[model samples]
Target chain A: MIKVYKELNNILLVNLNIKEASLENGDAFKAEVIKLFDKYHKSIAINMSAVEYIDSSFLGSIVSVFKHLISFQADVVLVGLSKDITNLFALTRLDKVFKIYNSFDEITNQ
Target chain B: MAQLASKQFLLPNTRQSIKASVQEVLDFVINSLPAGVNTEGISFKIEVIIIELLTNGIKHAGTIETFLDVTINEDNINIDKKDFGNRFHPGNITSLLVYDVGHKELLTKDGLHSMYAVVESDTQIRFVCEEENGDEVLDVSNLMEHFGLLIITKSSDTFTYEYDVDTGLNTFSVIIDLN
Candidate 1:
């Protein structure tokens, strides 16, 4: 199982072990991300410091989780987005949708 | 060990040299593979898939002072190509999110850009490719400039990419069922 740690606020840090975070762990990953939404009414911060490759299914999972959180007026932020990962997000126009940060410090300050 | 697979290659340090390198290995795999498999769509698929991975590494992974390790087995294949330069930053890995299956609402008129162009099935070769009259001449050596991202996804039943920055090494693997 991938590591999921909930922080002081509604901060959810998901540390993926591999550089490529695609559909291999799609359902379980979705479930973990959604679990944060279901429990935390505060802001949700996803720390993707360890991931490198996130494919379409992985993007959908993130979007699906965001939808659930937004319904509850929650905020979501993604941290440590790599150049390649950020490019893909930008390509899909998801860069506008996601609150991406270079590091945890950038988001934690906000 | 019952599960023993190996891929030994003498990878020269130039971009042009990799074409023969990729094709030779693909040919070896094609020739040595189990028979009666339809490689119709997949035959074209290999061009995109192989080039994307190999070229990306050649272009970005930077230095070339090492060998590539490729492992093929019954279930999956593991391809590890490392240059082991000073810049292999283990901490900063590039993550890309491409969609193989599409969203009902977000369909692009140009099919190549769409990630959802693929179908879901664990079996194998569940990819969809539109009729493309591409450039007549193609060099796997210069793949990034020519090939679209869709080829990589369409070529395999499953694909994964990883590059270790600390190690300055990149690895990509594709698993397909020719049966």
Candidate 2:
């Protein structure tokens, strides 16, 4: 469900290869991401370019991971969101809290 | 607006089942629309609405039967969802609650600028989010993750919930304008 693209400057880039991100895999997704964070202790950039739909449960899991990473001074940023998906983030006002980018290279280059 | 298509679905109280049903519902709506009718926006809204409806049902209602009716009209899409679970306590949510990074507080309307619940009547409650058009930012965090009702209300033109005492049915009706 998730593929690790690379680790650059202690920043981890992971890609979610799922069409729908919802309650079905919410817990597992959170666990997997948390495990990665624990092992690498690096800031993570999630590329959600393939996720067409997402629900509050999955969103909650994302928030949970963010809370866990914050204590370690790590953050979770999103990249490559579709228009409607971007609207969803804006709708819930998460765009203000999370650093969202248009592409994976934006984060790696920065 | 005339009814273009209508269908009902009985889904299991599981995320996988409900997720699959939402896809079916979205596909049905897409096939029902006339040629050249742009559905890019409405389709996304409908997907969010249906997922929220069934997931909320399962989360609150437990192992109860759930049914969703999708009716597509000329200018609107109507979704009626029913779950035989516990009754929702809208009155319990009294104040305008807002949460930020490290804390949450209950404030009056003047102090807050985001979504809150309002008890419209004995059997109905309307969620007053930031904007009816759903374009404005909610100015709140999703940390609570209690956004199912708020999301449904903001995504639809009209959103209402009713509990039938005799039938013991909790019904959520939503209408999305197709214009």
Q: How well is each residue in B26-81 modelled by candidate 2, as lDDT tens digits?
A: 99989988556678878888888988998888778885568889898888888898
DockQ of each: 0.01, 0.49
**Candidate 2 residue-wise lDDT, A16-36, digit = tens:** 999988888889999999999
lDDT of 1 at A70: 63
How high is the CA lDDT of each candidate model?
0.51, 0.76
Point out the worst 10-residue segment of candidate 2 chain A by lDDT: A88-97
TM-score (2 decimals) of chain A in model 2:
0.96
Per-residue lDDT of model 1, residues A1-110, tens digit only: 44655465646655555555544565677787677567655666777768855555466577666666666777667878776567556544456566887876665577
Native contacts, share recovered per candidate: 0.00, 0.41
Q: What does candidate 1's lDDT look like per residue over B76-162, in tens digits?
A: 444444555433221132222222433122212232233322223211112233432333432212111122234454556665444
Q: After the best TM-score superposition of candidate 2, give how far the Cα of residue B126 lies from its true spot, in angstroms.
A: 1.6
